[model samples]
Target: MSQATPTSQSQNVQTVTIEREMNEYGALTVHVDGQNATRHIVEYASDELKTILRQLPSGSSVPLTIEPIGTRGNAWRATSLTQ
Candidate 1:
């Protein structure tokens, strides 16, 4: 058999700020400071989330990854920013 790609093991995630969001009652809410439309949270926060958002533009498309939290159920944490 052939060797597998070394980069295949890791997942690349993307995300956009779309304004600041908050976690309320176990739900991460997506809301804008001056907007009225709000969406329910899809995932919780992790070190990965912060790391990714830091790189992506405030409104650009990007990738985001979801990793296991070790038996506490899986969480979608941000990984890196992308075009």
Candidate 2:
């Protein structure tokens, strides 16, 4: 038997702000605002995305295309960013 990998489903573009914080485990975590005022943690981010996030000031929102990651789909990753 073989286990199947989870496919990444790109979500609609949305305007959101990002923040970096330390989780309970003391690891750095990046969070973004989702639709309906929901908040999601980014488990994976590309180098480009990281650069953009770093340049953004606090509470700055930008248009981005994100995709849900992980089997539970509780985490997200930035696929595209529009400054």
Candidate 3:
């Protein structure tokens, strides 16, 4: 009999700052330094992180740890966020 081993996906975490945008839909985006100018979306941010982000004023440069989603090299989601 042959058995298959399960593998876990590695997490890619990076510290970055939020780049707030002014529009109807309040979306969160961050730009990682030394990389392309593509804006990453914080789609899967935690509640605590989301609350902290929401309180911050526009154009705020707060450091945060973000994890990129599947296949999205430029897209990101906050894992650990602090003001």
lDDT of each: 0.38, 0.55, 0.55
Clashing pairs in 3: none
- In the range 1-83, model 1's lDDT, one tens digit per residue, is 45333243444342423443343333333332344643333443555655444444435433334333233333333333444
Superposed by TM-score, candidate 3 places the C-alpha of residue 24 at a distance from the truth, in angstroms, of 6.0
**Which 10-residue span in candidate 1 carries the lowest summed lDDT?**
66-75
For 16-71, candidate 3 gives per-residue lDDT tens digits of 45567523354666655556654555454466666766676655665565555655
Candidate 2's TM-score reads: 0.57
RMSD of every prediction: 9.7, 4.5, 6.3
Model 1 TM-score, all chains together: 0.30
Model 1 regions more than 4 Å off: 1-20, 24-61
For the record, the alpha-carbon RMSD of candidate 1 to the native fold, in angstroms, is 9.7
Model 3 TM-score is: 0.55
lDDT by residue (tens digit), candidate 2, 8-83: 4346467776554425432223345554444454543576665655566656677777666655645656667765
